[model samples]
Target: MGITIFEDSYRHKGLRRKLIEELRRKGIRDERVLNAFDKVPRHLFMDSSFVEFAYQDKAFPIAAGQTISQPYTVAFMTELLNIKPLDKVFEVGTGSGYQTAILSELGAKVYTIERQKDLFQSCQHLLKMLGYNPLYFFGDGYLGKPSYAPYDKIIVTAGAPEIPKDLIAQLAIGGRMVIPIGTSDLQVMTTLDRISPTQVDIHEHGNFVFVPMLKGTNNR
Candidate 1:
């Protein structure tokens, strides 16, 4: 995938502004998250066919049976992470790279992994085109990126059956992780605050439905 071209027209900006307002009303009070949302053109992360629906506060299908997460969900999760400048972030399930772009915009060094080879390649190209430089990996997300251990923050975009011990182990002391855990039908948005080497605090926010966190990579 070489350089690609696309236009972010004034109309798109206007719709995104309206989306920002919608997110604010729905309890997404983080201004930095809102600003990141305002900057990244969601349409560019979507297929050309779904471009018109890009700014809507809704989830839409992307490649490899994954869906670009709803804007509200993304904002909610980001707000929970409490990102700071230069915080090392490891992201599981880099679907479409929209959330990855958000993390980058918020000044985090993002390391993202995708199980689907197609999404991994396409998102890598698109984020690069948009000038976001997160390190990208095409592999199993369940294993987490251990080489980049001691991450200041970690976010899992997919719903896990339970908390992944590997990811928890990679977090830096006093680091935070936002993940959704439950069955395939639904999940509870959970956050883990690593207090010490053996002690961690777990908290649940609310319920959300996400694509299941799967093991291994899919060539398709």
Candidate 2:
């Protein structure tokens, strides 16, 4: 479903504030991430039926059989990347475009990819209408976007069976990538810091669940 509602009421702001406090209690300490959350109206990214619950720290179903990542999950992954202003960030999934907006709020030059055509189009439209300017791609994210290679940071929003090498190759030396790797049911959130062209530092953050990252685009 496309985002049809644009109004963010006082109640919505109040609810979002509560959600941010909840995230803080959950140990999300990055003030920048919190401020971004405070600015973006997440309800605008959600379908109308779920808009009322948009501020909750939970994931909800969107179109194309995909689920938006929970607010805490979004904050966690984003905070891990430690995005710098104007950092070129390559995002693996553009589902809902909520994360993309958050990245834009952080002043990242975002290059986001979505394998699902429906999501790619809808997210692109909504973000444009909302004033975000991320470069959007409708293709297999596994291949990454080589045209804009050597990104300062990479974030894969889905659970991948394994880290795609192409994405790693696209990362600039000293770049960091946050991806969830494991089976379909569970994934360990992992970070790869490319210290050099041939070397990386790997660390596991924790376990989280996400929709599986697919191989190719889905036109339907």
Candidate 3:
């Protein structure tokens, strides 16, 4: 893969710091999550046209029909996952690789899937250039990654019509899965904690908007 060069200057760092403060004021109390945001250069993950607003706590369009999730949403989901160092995290969408970098920054061994071939390839290159080493695959997010089962935490970054049973099955007992389930326009942020082999504790956070989680891979 060819290296994509982007500069991260002091101005960008200042902007990120401000963004973190904004997130904190918005009730995101996880220091680790904030720290991850502090480290990753959000502008570097965005297109040149959108880079100026990268730290604005909003979503921006990416290569696929997907958006790089808003900073608040990303922080909220990461906080929900309660990530720990070396924890195995299964991520459902690898859009722009921004969230993937955050997971890496929080010290998780991330295995992420993206169905859009263009996004999968570009994000893989960008993550590698940024020195993130997450295992990335181009496949269906609904199917999850069974070859590396029993993840410590699973995070789905797209809106799903229903909770994917296959993904739930891939969660380790005692593991947590954060997903957005509802219609295409809006979704309730829900978390499933697997307490036993067949029992899961469900909790719903607020609603958020995301691209629909589609089936199968876009090999083109």
Candidate 4:
């Protein structure tokens, strides 16, 4: 098997510069976040049918009835995480692996868990194809990945009944987690900054709607 010359050629004369400029105009201010968004090709993570909308700042459905978060939402969440080069991030929902890919681009070592087996497998393949280094897993998104405990940042992509105690316990001292909490149809996006063993700060971003995060993982 040989590499495609046209693929390399198109990449050189690619769609990225325009994408970066558009994202900037949309107010994605963090240069590092922007660079990550710029580097990971969103179109590649999506189905061919939706590639045209890849850079349009909108969410699109992938396998397993999950969506690739809108670019703005993904950037907003990632920015809230306040990723540092040394941060080890635990992503609660793998979705289409778009957010995980973006986090990887921002230089975080990502450990993401997805409940849907098909979506998990698809995303794992996509990330590998894109040369992203993420530790993808199949399991409930609720518990978070305890094996990689004490993460610097944790982000939940779906709405949960409450902030899972399991995930909070897994947060490193002084680390932060950005999550969505409430019923499936209605929720609040919040950032929890842990100051100590018994101290945390909550900054809630009014409202949002997300799929319910189910418990009882099939992980063995």
Candidate 5:
């Protein structure tokens, strides 16, 4: 795989500012989340072919049948997590690493996993080039990173048929998780706040679309 070259120019920053305003208008009130959108160069995470639409509030296809999620979706989910600086975050479906960069920007120590090897490697390289350091792993997202259990927060980027029990088990007491759950065609954005050792408060936010979260790793 050749190195994907990207430039973060002044024009890109201006577009990002506009994107932030659009997100605010869409009801994303978290200041930190908005600041992250301002800091990360969204265009750097997209293929050069779709660079023009990078700052748009829309999803774009990436490698391995995945997508860089719409900006509002990212902000909505990130806001649900209510991330605190230096919080330990476990992320499923690293995809384009754009969301991972946002988590890192908000001062979360993110541990992200990806099942597709191509996306895993490419996203790792791009994130490094952009200087956003988050621990990366290639594995099945259905099985949350057990070795690093008790995460303060967890975010799943893909749409799941149901919430994975292992993910809930991995959350620390009083931890939070943001995931999209429902069918492959459409999903409801849900937030699970672990209130006790055995209790979690689940809240449904709204509807969104995302790639299906597959069960196992794709070595191909």
Candidate 6:
């Protein structure tokens, strides 16, 4: 019955502070984004053995060969999306659901997709336990969930060869998407703002490394 996993607040607090300092050094300026970073108990999103390092501004390995996105990466992407309270968000990789938790905390209605069955099950349970009602799905992120198409904000936690055209098509007229495109060895973190049904502006903002985004799952 590993039903309850409480975060070590005292330890996380110090690391959380360190994470914030790193964000400042890295030019993450949104205060709301910073709050999301501090409030989301990231330690709750990692394996117990590594909870000790959860807020270190570094990615920690989670199940299914996934790493919880770095704290600064979360903050940076959230800031880039400029998500409002009423925005509907779609997360391409649920992983440990830490980013999903932050999105929910920021008042965005989240629908997250995780391909690995085990990771999906693990993240879904933890999210439910935390009282976050982010809709969880086991499927290929390459094909954005059509049932929830027209998302106001979409974020991909894994690296893609290119922004999935289907995902862009799913974005609302004025919606935005943040994704890491290119290869793991060299990926560019870019934000796509849908200017219209037929036009979008791409803003490139440095780079990151992540596991490759794969296709398909057993949700059939």
Candidate with maximal lDDT: 2
lDDT of 3: 0.93
Model 2 CA deviation exceeding 4 Å by range: 1-4
Predict model 1's lDDT versus the native: 0.94
What value of lDDT does candidate 5 attain over all alpha carbons?
0.93
Task: Report the lDDT tens digits of candidate 4 across residue range 1-220.
Answer: 3333113235432566666777778677889988887677777778878766667767788877778877778887888888998689999888888899888888899999988877877777668877887988888777777888989999999888888888889999999999988987898989998899998888997687777788765432
Q: Report the poorest 10 consecutive residues by lDDT, candidate 4.
A: 1-10
Better of 3 and 4 by TM-score: 3
Tens digits of per-residue lDDT for model 3 on 1-220?
2233468899999999999999999999999899999999999889889988999989999886779999999999999999999999999989899999999999999999999999899987778878999998989999998999999999999999999999999999999999999999999999999999999999999999999999998977
Error of 5 at 34 (Å): 0.7
The sequence of per-residue lDDT tens digits that candidate 1 reaches over residues 50-147 is 98899999999998889999999999999999999999999999999999999999999999999998888888878888899999998988789888
Ten residues in a row with the worst lDDT in model 1?
1-10
Poorest stretch of ten by lDDT in candidate 3: 1-10
- The TM-scores, one per candidate, come to 0.97, 0.97, 0.97, 0.89, 0.97, 0.93
lDDT of 6 by residue, 1-220 (tens): 5645764466677778788878989899988888888777788888889866776778888887678878888888888889899689999988889989989988999999988888888887777777889888888989989898889999998889998999999999889999999986778999999999899999999978888888787442
lDDT for each candidate structure: 0.94, 0.95, 0.93, 0.81, 0.93, 0.86
Lowest summed lDDT across 10 adjacent residues in model 6 is found at: 1-10
Would you list the clashing residue pairs of candidate 5?
none
Q: Model 6, residue 59: what's the lDDT?
A: 85
lDDT of 1 at 110: 97
Order the candidates by lDDT, highest first: 2, 1, 3, 5, 6, 4
* Model 5 residue 129 lDDT score: 81
Model 2, span 1-220: residue lDDT tens: 3333778789999999999999999999999999999999999888888988899999999999999899999999999999999999999999999999999999999999999988999988778888999999999999999999989999999999998999999999999999999999999999999999899999999999999999989998
